[model samples]
Target: MKLTPFLAAAAAILIASCGGSNDALDGPSGPAMGGGAGAAGSAGGGTGGAGGTSEPQDAGDSGEDGSNPDAPPGKTAEEACKTYVGAYCSQLGKCSPIYLQLIWKDAAACEASLVPVCVKSLGLPDTAKTPEFTASCGEAIGALDCSSFMGRKVPASCNPPTGPRADGAACGEDGQCANGYCATPLDQACGTCASRAAEDQDCDRDDDCAFGLICSKDNKCTPYVAKGGGCDENHPCEPGLSCKGAVGPTKGSCTDPAGPGQACDTQQIALPGCDLNAGYFCHLVTHVCQKMDLSQAGEACGVVNNGYSACTQSSMCKTNGGMSGTCLAPANSGDACDLVDGPYCVPPLRCVGNVCTELDPAGCK
Candidate 1:
């Protein structure tokens, strides 16, 4: 955003009043902290307050504090302008042409806050004649304004004119349409025909169907596949059945085929397809095929006794000896000193002797 001249003047006055004693504020005998020049030595002894400087602790130390060093001095108009403008600009994440509008509108406000730093850094007799500050501010504003419309698409005026338009021909703004039927004023190319399958079922690949169902095969709209039903290569089964291992080579099988009391005793019988309604191959006492609840059966067979949920990422799952499960994090993440990189608990219970303790605090309880 740009700072107004009035705001800049006010800012310069405010900053000058606040930092009128920069010369009195001592610094170490070295370059200024923010790459400026100042006398060496400490402002005061011992620990200084925030934004304050103390005695030189080291040789390479520059006493420039984190506060803005580029501020202008005195209660001049230019100093005020720079102060407000710089502060507002710092808040903007990125610089662009639109920012110039802001700069122009808010120049005065920024100057009120920034002039003091400018005066200290520039050593201007008066704020108005500070060429360095003027050049910097102008360049910053100009750069943003020039680059404002870089990625925007060219307007329709740049396009070649077409012959007399038809009744319902493709049109964008009111200027392009013949009878105004398609003169819709949208942000981008407007007035376009709507797609046909706006209400059709969602589908990815094929094969998510029964014997009778056939996918429209159209990229846009495909037939819906019920949960646990046979689907084509493109369509996917419900939540549990991912596309990768559905049936064939890269196919998936249900670990639990039979219902509760059925037997799963057959080497040939693989796990059921992702489609639970189609049926499942239960793991009875003998490894044979027995129809069962594919969803529940898969969950029951997959779960570890320790109550850890199955997750795709190895980091999410933790395995120790024969017992494996998901890792748990302490309630207060910051307070817990035993946290690992991903917040998992460290193994073992407690430490021995006078050495530091290294054990799972949760497991001990």
Candidate 2:
């Protein structure tokens, strides 16, 4: 029932392992689009997450007001970080008051804590700041209706601003690339910028391709396999399709997530059957699809008989050596953490005992 497109579409395999397997995540404060440790502006990244820093930030300080005459033309990445969250929450409040209620104490609380959460996720350094596309990004998010916001069909304005990195420069995030493309190999975190390969060209991941194609078994960027097509770790499926295998069907095939009230195996990891990102889970008693109960960080939480914790995505009910537990907020990478909560560690990093540790690159299967 661990679902939330907030982390790598909730189902896509990623380097952050939960329960000792590759389950890509959008950290409690993970970016909106891409799941693995991508910055807010990276593909499949930017937007949404759990409670942020302890201090409640002033919403007006996000550079939204044209009060600073001495300020630069565009907002800095650090400033834009707050602006993005503020706009997103403000817009979502129009459609999903329930979600906002569960995540924060109130709309004002969301702006304060969540804004800092977004800035931390982007790993902003107060010293090394740069201009970013702010007005358009905030406007695009603020303009979204419930449907578009839920689907997270973010506009291109939210992408990371072009940085100083050159084409051959080594980078870990798209924001570091001047061309806005960081072609990382599947086996590693850092990659060279602007290494786009044509179809049929040798590649290790879809990022290596120039266009809409997947890297096949032979390491060629080719058309993605269609839904219901044969698939495995070696063969890639088309976008939005999950390659799954279950007890009844041992064969792997590209399949769509089960819709509302559809049958599914709640126990199967590769084929949970239900579309978790869409806010559905396989019910234990009815054995049918159902919506999940939301429990934001800082709220009370507990493990029911079935082993499910009500904490929101990227967070966990931390016992902290007590009988009762409270959901803890997601922390930054390299920060202190407890092993109980996924949110305790930032995206791409998992809590290992008392510290957040990076997982193996191969874990992002």
Candidate 3:
């Protein structure tokens, strides 16, 4: 039977599952199977049927040979299969049952030739719970037999288990928690039930604490207690009020003291005083004040002051410096000398051998 159609159908299924993004199989034709039929036929020339090939061997054909140089040393057959399958799947984009069967056949042929690592790598576990391998050689050659492979059966954990826990708790061994257990130092028990505590829990660091709390140095959960009265580091008070130590020595409270000419109205408690110099209002919440006019501040102050333009506001000049002035260009002197803040300077002030000289208005002095 032609296998090309089957291969195409399988490939199409995989491509569809992948959102039909692959353009490699866009051609009008499918893979030709008869091309390799002759090679297999020659290998089985002595057989009766046309296009016949020697019968593929079963797992029992090759017994374990620990000391055999032709077999992979210190490696299990399933492990080898995982490595080979991973490599093959990387090239094929996806692993299919047929690909596994082909790999098994190829591994068997290599084993018969006494190729080292081939047989041991392809051998399946005898205690496989499922009939992973099919009886038909053709069917077996093109199928993934994962029933006996440990990597396929218990894929969550390999020989040495390590990964995230399914229950959202730390794990260390198979017995720690139930599903998807991972080995970790914190969770010594392999499958111990984890607790959802708000405080005094086993935590590696502060980041493990709840949303508003932090892990303390003693491994306890502590709320972000702000200092001075209001919002602590965790429960920050709104803008205009700062977290300060309250009446008690250890407690904190959010409060805003009334400024000069300002009333102690609770509603306007967070309102900031107007900076006559800077022309900006300070945000009590973040303790940061903003300028109202940045261009004037830039011109009066400097271009690179605090990443803000000095001319942002006219008041910035009065606050930043005692000088209340606008930007001005210096007057020019004809001696190639630097200009200074002045109305005008004498002309024809040429540099004579490094000495500046001002020409007499009448002619030369």
Candidate 4:
């Protein structure tokens, strides 16, 4: 079935690098290159989804690991889910502390927040969890460096346990498929197992490829374009680089994004826009990319020279058909959003009938 990568949103968020220094990217209240105060967060504060934190927080390495003395013993698959979650969150927390701070309170809270996601996406059914796979999975996750962690790379050991279902068998999850791929058709809930595609192989979607490869518009599994390489809507550039001059048959070269005061337009992806990872957004009003004051939650936004973003990563701009909007936090499931600050609920949760609601979890489904 035609499918998108489960980490598609995460991939977009990767443009917001965790660490970098920009002269126009100082803290809020500081002087910017062209006009207004430098924003508190980096250029990608409003990029939304995960990794919205634009500036580098440097919260230090998350000390916990599967090997930590105080860590829980993952003797069962259920417990191993926790171990895997901890290993992932630990590295993520240290990569961008401020973003996590905006959501959960601490490392433990962060782990708690993301555990269900990891478990639901890559884990076995509650009745199917086994310990033999748990230990190896947790250890593999704990060994991931920041690059792999940020890329959402799945360790070989972390793959779902092999099952009796053969390729082409009806399956609801990866664990049920012998080939480890459940080829769900677009807009369908169920799928069948299929063999994975390799680089240069024909493919219809991202999930058909093996690790580190993505399906291109040409319907082939290919590696991501490197920095300074030509790319377009069909040819995606590597994370941290933006495409410039990509239009029609002529491809654009991936280049470092523009900094604050640089000319930009969100409508034009081919242009060398602002540094998205730094929390710089293109201001439609001024037609220039500018840093937003991330600390300006509850403050008015969308005004003249206010940049595309006025709030922190966790929050969004809520404009109710007015000339201006306010920055506010997201609501939880079943929470009333009528009086909330942002326009909508958090990622993975949407405003359904004015209440935040959960959607299908990523992967397999």
Each prediction's TM-score versus the true structure = 0.19, 0.47, 0.19, 0.57
Residues 1-365, model 4: lDDT tens digits: 12221113122111111100110011110000000112222233122112111111111222222123333454654465577657645654664343334333456864565455435543433112244454455666567664344333555554444455688766554555555555543223345777668777987655556545556667776665667788765665554456677778888787766667877755445456554434466666666777544445577655534444445433545567764567666556666543123334443344444555453423332
Runs of candidate 3 with Cα error greater than 4 angstroms are 1-197, 202-206, 216-219, 223-241, 246-249, 255-288, 291-304, 307-365
Winner by lDDT between candidate 4 and candidate 3: 4
lDDT on C-alpha atoms for all candidate structures: 0.22, 0.41, 0.23, 0.43
lDDT of 2 by residue, 1-365 (tens): 11232232211101100111111223232221112221111111111211110000011222322123333365655567566656755754554443344344445765664444344334422112233444345555676554334432334444334546678876544445565445543223445656446667876543344333434546775544557776553453443344566233354676775566766555433443454433355555665555555566676654344323355434555666643467666565566764323345444354544455553322221
Better of 1 and 2 by TM-score: 2
Point out the higher-scoring one by lDDT: 1 or 4. 4
Query: What's the CA RMSD for each of the models?
Result: 29.9, 11.5, 34.4, 11.0
What tens-digit string does per-residue lDDT give for candidate 3 at 61-113? 21121111233344444444444333323322222222212212233331221
lDDT of candidate 4 at residue 337, scale 0 to 100: 44
Give the poorly placed runs of model 2, Cα more than 4 Å off. Answer: 1-6, 10-81, 89-132, 143-154, 159-162, 168-173, 182-272, 294-303, 317-343, 346-365
